[model samples]
Target chain A: MPAPLSRRHLLARGTTAGFFIVAGQWLWLTPREAEARVFDPQVLSPEQCKALSILGDALVPGAADAGIAAYIDLQLQAGDESLLIGKYLGVDTPAQTEFYRAAADNVISLAGDKNSMQTFATNMASDSLSGWAGPPASYVLFVLRADALDVTYGTPEGFERLGIPYMAQIKPDKPW
Target chain B: MVSKNCDVIIVGAGAAGLTLAARLAEGGKSVSILEAGPERKLGDLVSSQIWARKLKWSEPAVSESGNHKIGHAFNAGTGTGGSALHHYGVWLRMHEGDFSLSSDHGVGLDWPLNYEELAPYYDQVQAEIGLSGDSVKERWRPQGAPYPMPPLPLFAQSRVLAKGFAKTGRHTSPLPLAINSEPYQGRPACHYDGWCDSGCSIGALGNPLAVWLPRALAAGALLEHNARVSRVIRDANNTQRVESVEYLQDGERKTMQADRIIVAAFAVQSVRILLSSATEQHSAPGNHSDKLGRYLMTHPAGTIFGLFDEETYPHQGVTAGQLLSHDDYDEKDAAGGFGSSQWMIGHAIKPHDLLGYGTNRPDIFGAELEPWLKRASRHLGNMTVVCEDIPLPENRITLSDRLDRDGIAHAHAHHDLEPSAAARCTQRMSEGADILRAAGASEVWAGPRIGQHHMGGAVMGSNPEESVTDAFGRVHDTDNLYVAGPALFPSSGAVNPTFTITALASRQADHILSIN
Candidate 1:
């Protein structure tokens, strides 16, 4: 649930040092690294990306490792071709970037180092986050969780991890 | 301009458009279809849930509002096959009482045609599409030809949930589905993989890709992909007849002329197309009565989920669910509510996505997430309750003031659930939770009441003053323009609308053919 290995450092260093530290494991080249090795975010800021990764990981443990933030950033850059679950939830494509930013900003203001990540997540679920702005905290939590689930267990590999059959009539050549 | 003439020009390549196109083309008529989205084939339906997001409505977003919002993006789809490509294939007929809503309950508008008039077409469509179910087991089912295929095998979740219906003195029947149980009509049978929402790539489910698209293509129907229809064009000399259509294709505005035109772009989009057809000489076709976008309706529905001690294997069957109970479907005057409702029991569920087990429970996460998901993956029991939405003229679709980048006005859908229908949905959801508890569930919970299907707007009626179209789906104001989808429905029946949409299209095709 901790923040990603600062994008500032990834830029300061070269592509060789661009490694994601997930679940105490040092992966040489994760999917996130492979997809966006030199990350230049279009819609999301570094702080917003960090906040989304933390929030998503808190909701779904392996989501950070699943590159939820990268997946989201990629979709945001996709514009009308966004594959985000929020697209299906009635958040218009043009407004999706603002929606995610505002929600992430709300999370940042609420979780001012005083509360644990678990406490923040629980407050989010209960809609008890004081002075919360933007969309309802519960709704934001739902969207983030859904996004996390998308990356964590929405793929054939993820289904196999849970012992469910990955029966495919036409299998996806690549995970989004 | 890529100008061409055809016998018929159908707007939108969704279920209704494809069905009508296939039928008319089979009768030796040259058919042309304009689809707002990309071309989709059965081979494009990948099995991964993440990749499945591409199958949903990816066109310009439809603005929605009101207490129970019509879930346009979730319910509607884009591309060649349209929404039917990603549908779960739950095909149920509207009950006889569903035809006359105002006459029976004094609530919504009554359909121009009764179930008996539509029943023969429904039978013909069902037989053609190959529905699988046991008619005798469906005690409350209306009279029709028995399903062409035996019912799909029920999984453990359905078996467990059936006990709840039995314990509550209710009868359970195998869910009628458009999915093939065995290899039929050269299409492969379902593998019970539970990916219906992701689009059935194997041609097992009777999606447009497997059913109508091939027929339409084989019968020489020309489908124009990525061609977003702007408006229907009326002839200058004869204002009463629609002569052509204006549309955008490959970044160029083009016009296509035809002897006949049918707008089958689903409910909201269909209404948008008609409303955008407004000209100075005449208002939008079907707007003479000021009832073009009136009487919008969407079913108020929810799901009930539970954790059972026994191994349920919830993901072993179809996504449309495995069983149905219409024992109380026809009861409109129940104490708690005033609309018909039905229960689709035991869906083959996943751990993610909107209706999946994981997303439903945002409370269980962090360190305690994987175990819960794993357990639910193996032992979850779930069923959905679909309550009828009574049509209200105030709940309508209108052209939004804001326009898309392409200068086409976006469609705004406003729908407020009727108090009676809301009450009925709440009651059914509560009963569903109780049923889960009675079915030996260790824990049970109810999901939020969300909009299920979109229907009505540009409704059909006997009186031209009250409705946009006549019984034949032809607009009263225009001779050549017709609507052939759920948008033509006068009443929002509790059952799924795909079967009825196809049946209505069949009827419309017959009418068109008989005209000349």
Candidate 2:
């Protein structure tokens, strides 16, 4: 059997064009450049939304462009009416807002070094980040990545990007 | 006794309640169903997984405590059809041994009626709902009527995963599904787009909306939505006879008198209703023996995932998976295990959500995430292992001290898997990985063993001292009160409980009709 694709090679190919290469260091382009700027979030504070966008984009490329922050903010504002997958995974509907706010605050504190988003995410995944508090960093990372995936690759156009057929019985109007 | 407004009042508009309502109404009885959730129409059944969350249980959450907490929010549904609206159409019958758990192995409670008594009802329900499968190929399946429609065609994903069973010297058969493979009756055929979890809008899957609600409406069964039933009220003169049902509709406490009542609001809620009926005058009905909320059971289930070299195109078939292997279903004494188990193979998975390929793997993210997910979306092959849970009295559902906004006590489920049942789950998961590897999977991984089909709590038995209900699902303490759903199950069989729930409800309806 052929060897598994190496991480280094995958990253090398990933940084070619879509990524922002600044000062010989590759960084994910901020979501602000891709999405609309004049947006009013209902639930998340400005800082919390920014942190979510940055962390979400770092975890899943193009998630910001897919409106990850807006999606999460909309869901959080919906309270019990939220369509988030976290509702099914033991996170109560009322606590969903606090869960995201706390995680986003933690992300802002940890991701201070803008040079390496991947390294920051790796530390979050392993829970090796110093002074980490609240719901485990790994869990937050998992939920964020899942939310990002929902906005990015869970739609018909997103399926196109992954080369999978979107044989939806009734197509969704938007990713929501 | 209070004046009666209806002959029968069903607490929930779910699979069991709706089925019973249709049957009872058709038999010239006035039936009224009180549903807690908002009314759901076929057009409301959107195909988006994100939008599909609307179909799930939205009532005040059921507090859970257990080694394997039942995914109640995900598993239980709300609205007109209840949980069956989002069910994946995996219709399966319990093996004969499943009926007599204590009689056969001295573990768990035994059913009041044996498999022979329920077999005819099962056949009748299968025919009524229109199941699809090859009965002959299902060697382990109990004797029953053949499926009305042919089995759903295996998509590329199931075909690729079937190779794993073949390579491992295991047998597989077309999964018996309540979905229509071809146009049957007035319902259209399943387009095989894998959207059954989002509620089959095309009326192909035999959800309550497609199978029972139409018949119920046509039969003039009064249906009320957003009506949260509080408790069944007993007659002031005689506590043995239920008089009426008190419920909250439009934020007003209302009482609807009925000659008979059936609580079919799934397991925990059904038990909660009974437990909440505790008044100053009398203890909750069926609590005389303190067995009303005991033996709460849920199947120990988890998915085993693999990435095959072949382009499996894992997003093709139904969400319930395309094939089933019940080879060890009746082997309660298998080595290193104490219960039955089965594998549902080749689920049509998605990129997001709790069970999605992207979410399960938390370790893989950032640059490596997209590539891995893209590959997994195409090459992934996954199967779910469902193992029987031993019914332990300690694994119970009780009324919690905590109250919801409506001031009603919440239901709390406390479950701990028996060691033997846990052992069975572990053994099956190990075998699942091996099967995937044998099928030429380069990598194989398994998800955490979690709870599936919730049952028991108010289980049925011949002895009133040991169980809450009788053979016909009539509560032992009351003459007109019945429990018609998986909540009446005495054992947690390693199969989806909807088919059996429908069957039991059918039998209960027959009994009720015959008496009147």
Candidate 3:
């Protein structure tokens, strides 16, 4: 088997606040630290990017192999379909851009003018919920869930990462 | 000199044609099989199975407007082993009523022979080509020799669904499938990889290309590929004797004289060839009854896909589990369904297939789809509810005025569901869905109607006036011109028709051998 397609081509991008920790990763954010990720590249800010790198490392642990920051940087620069399970839903994309912008505004509205992006994260994090079978939001939940599934079920590393065991037998009489 | 010679000759290769010539010496047979299309393989099965229009067939037969569209381009096999190459291998026998439709239903015509007459043929075919199942479970199955091989094991989903049917006091039996459960004959057993429709590379599933064609070749039957038989030639003195067949090989006109002939090109294409051969000189017998391509019938089935709290592991086994629920199978007298069809459970499904597969959930994309995807990863259990469509005259196949590249007309198929038939399908689907729910599906969804299993057109029966062939699949009024395959079916029972097709094919082969 040729080696699986490079993971260098895929990663995650998250924008919000509360010192988002990408956990394990590297970044060349222009700004030194703090408030770095919040700034868009089209409106690049060196001072803000330094802080964003730290935020990037906190969102996911072991983002190093994932190359989260560089991956997002490349994707932001390109225009192909995201290939994210979210993309196939026929939702997201340009809609996500406007949605994220509005969501940011909503957080701003809820948190008030004095609240920092960091404060908004603490508030949004409280919105955690339950029941995967619920409608509407279930779709979004399904996509995010699909991402975790894509990692855990679809890839060998994801399987290993999740401690999922695979049976080698084919045409088995019963499911284990 | 008027040509009466050919480079290679092919007998019925299940539509396996030109490609077989490559294996045999090029200019071999006094005549080769006149295949209408290229032999299809795994790479070609990629199109949507739910939509017949998207499938492979001759280009000319599809039409802009017609009451009888042959669905020819999609239904029949083109290349070698013809349509035999592209079939789903769920081989079930027609109930006893399948033969006596006229006496029993008073709607469709009847066969001269009954299930008992075809029973030995079924047994022989099962032996010659392995079919796997537990026939004892089929309470409604006609008296026949038991299947040669054991049934494929059911997964967790099928077992669960069985429990549901049991709860409702309904029966679920193993479907008599053409796929191998344990290895038999010379082929290995099925890995149960669920790749049957793509043409099994391993010979477990009984495809003509993998089974009958090889035996026919071993017996010295020749095969031709890409050599499209334009028409059947007749001698002027006695038109019934098929003296030769005209074909096109690499754009060159070719002809061959054969002692015997059989049109195994499938229902629609068989009729298409007959229509095309009805040029000025041989036009009399071809369309005598206007029944050459009429009375097309296919089982219009409904599907149900359910989502549960657990991952169903749909990819773990065969496309269909061994069990089938036949409570509704023999309901020709039943007022509910237009005709009877059984319920088969827990088949494997793909993530990207157009209907029912997980890839279809892209709509519930957001947070909603995640749980279902996760749930389906392990817990999706589904079932198929097959109900027979009454033979409607309007649902027929006819020659399209448009011609093929060789100037031969393509068949146009006309297919539609009557209100009563559609309602029957709906009731069957509801019952099936109830069975699934009873079996423990948290969420369930059934289907839009699909091309029921292909049947009809050029059907065989007793009388020459109303039918294309006589019992034993011999074309009427024409000696040596036998018709085989499911095209000989007069009434299609709601079950999978492939087993019956093989039974008749074996019967025709035996008859042919006996005559020779």
Candidate 4:
């Protein structure tokens, strides 16, 4: 019943949602919608996504449910057009996939029990984690935590939850 | 392999390029502007921080290395309005002493001309753009015409923050901003929604899209988006004159011949284009004296946050901040440190993102963040501290060995904060925390100091041997070549550069029209 979305509509709304493979067809959807549908990530591996979701949720509560992994995976697939917070934090889009993959591996390696994951997060924040490889643990922790924040608390709904006003002149159509 | 010819070709469509394009085209010079980014309209100025990243510089990533990186990707922007599209509208003029830094303080490079010479241009540009402020309260403001409109209204956050300045024996004045306070020049008044950094969509903010783009288009100036200019080509007959500009557009190489050329591609990219143009026959357009990409500068700025017991909703104002204090700005040679500093008080902020309070306190996370964020949403007060950067020859933009898909070299910016400047920033941040404490903050914290605005690289000066461009932004060795934008700034004056950049470009436009 809805007309097909136009480029002008997307620009006017400033949607952060992207196209994802749903039932073997490309569908424009929000990261939360993609996560609910269990859409396969185009760039990150299943193992990597699982690791990221677990660690991201551990870093910020409800991040996994808010689709942090799907949001990151979708942004990574966008390549140079990625709008992830990492773009502003010195990690360019071309190098983002590798950064996330290595960081996910590091998170998976240290994550075990709930208490252990919490300690690992603390250690990661302080850059004191043992056997941490790839980018500095503190920097990776900061980026992943920021990504989680983006998915969990950066939308109008999230602003409502925090008792803050989302007084947008041009509101985004979808919350990524 | 398309070729086009025009009387004037500007290699950017930002605040500087658009200002020049509008003036030159209206002056009867056929003008064409080549923008590297995609076309953008007022509708494209979205109100989300995540979507706002699309306005920033993305690809052929600039390689940065130094103790303090210039933050090229974050500070620079793409699309029609360029970086000004996402700017916060903090328009402050450089003090008189800022012009003669070397002459007065014996540090940093001095502007070729004094504030007296540039004051008229500043007045002219502000009138065209329409600034809002209480100039009488801004006692530190240089001799110039008052702002066109009254300052934007103060909110609870600013009212709470002003008490701190008063308690600390400092004065606070309404921040001079390019955002409209009322319906001025047909633009709507600001809603004070804290969306300035996400680009003002309602034309309340005086971005190029709202001020000059329409004027340029009406004057018959041509604008080409996604035209990535590689370099300017010197004429075979006259090495001192640029004949054409080579660029990539729509997957094909193109050439645009023009009688006059202006590189207004921000600071880093403007320097990069000149650096890439070097050949055996001639040095880069302004590099004959080896000062093409030297004296790179960015303001060493950071934010100070406080948790107040009073209910202070921090999101009811424009993002730039409500009040300003320049009490310590004029004293460049003070004891504990060197150079000027300012306080942009009571910034409207979000819960997340880089400058957000949540991100500043990286230690608080997991179950602890939400409650803290909910509390701070109604009880937080924050302000930014901007300190001057001492221009150093070693902090420069140079061509990198790595090439893009088009074989164009990447720009590598290296900048390290001077010891005295760093000391000054540190000292002021400490004072800022004390001010917040004096206002009865339960807890206080400060964000990491980072590079704010980019400037210099192709600095303007009187001596051709010591600087890249003349006071009018003409390249020393070229008759038709000029450089615009903040790239021509010889010193970072601890104030926002957009006003100065716009004023300087207006003066350049006048000079160009007069000569023709």
Which one wins on TM-score? 4
Chain A alone, TM-score per model = 0.77, 0.78, 0.34, 0.85
Give the winner by lDDT: 2 or 4. 4
Candidate 1: TM-score?
Answer: 0.94
User: Candidate 1: misplaced stretches above 4 Å?
Assistant: A1-31, A34-38, A112-115, B1-4
lDDT of 4: 0.91
For all predicted structures, in order, the TM-scores are: 0.94, 0.94, 0.70, 0.97
lDDT by candidate, in order shown: 0.88, 0.87, 0.56, 0.91
Q: What is the TM-score of chain A in candidate 1?
A: 0.77
Q: Candidate 4's residue-wise lDDT over A63-91, tens digit each?
A: 98899989999989888889888888788
Q: Score the docking of each candidate (DockQ).
A: 0.66, 0.50, 0.03, 0.70
Tens-digit lDDT string for candidate 4 (B1-516): 324488899999999999999999999999999999999999977788888889999998998999988898899999899999999999999999999999888888889999999999999999989999999999888999999999999999889889989998999999999999999899999999999988899999999999999999999999999999999999888888889999999999988998899999999999999999989878888998889889999999989999999999998899999999999899998987988999999999998888878778888888888999999999999999999999999999999999999999999999999999999999999999999999889999999999999999999999889999999999999999999999999999999999999999999999999995
Instruction: Compare candidates 1 and 4 on TM-score and give the better one.
Output: 4
Across B1-516, the per-residue lDDT of candidate 1 in tens digits comes to 324499999998888999999999999999999999998888788887777888788667888889999999988888988888888999999999999989988888989999999999999999999999999999998999999999999889999999998998989999999999998899888999998988998899999989998899999999989999999998887899888999998899999999999999999999999999998879999999899988888889999999999999998999999999999988888899889999999999889888899999988888899999899998899999999999998999999998987899999999999888899899999999989989999999988899987899999999999999999999999889999899999998899999999999999999999988
Q: TM-score for the first chain of model 2? A: 0.78
**How displaced is residue B408 in candidate 1, in Å?**
1.1
For every model shown, the clashing-pair count is: 0, 0, 80, 0
TM-score of 4: 0.97
Instruction: Compare the candidates by DockQ and give the number of the best one.
Output: 4
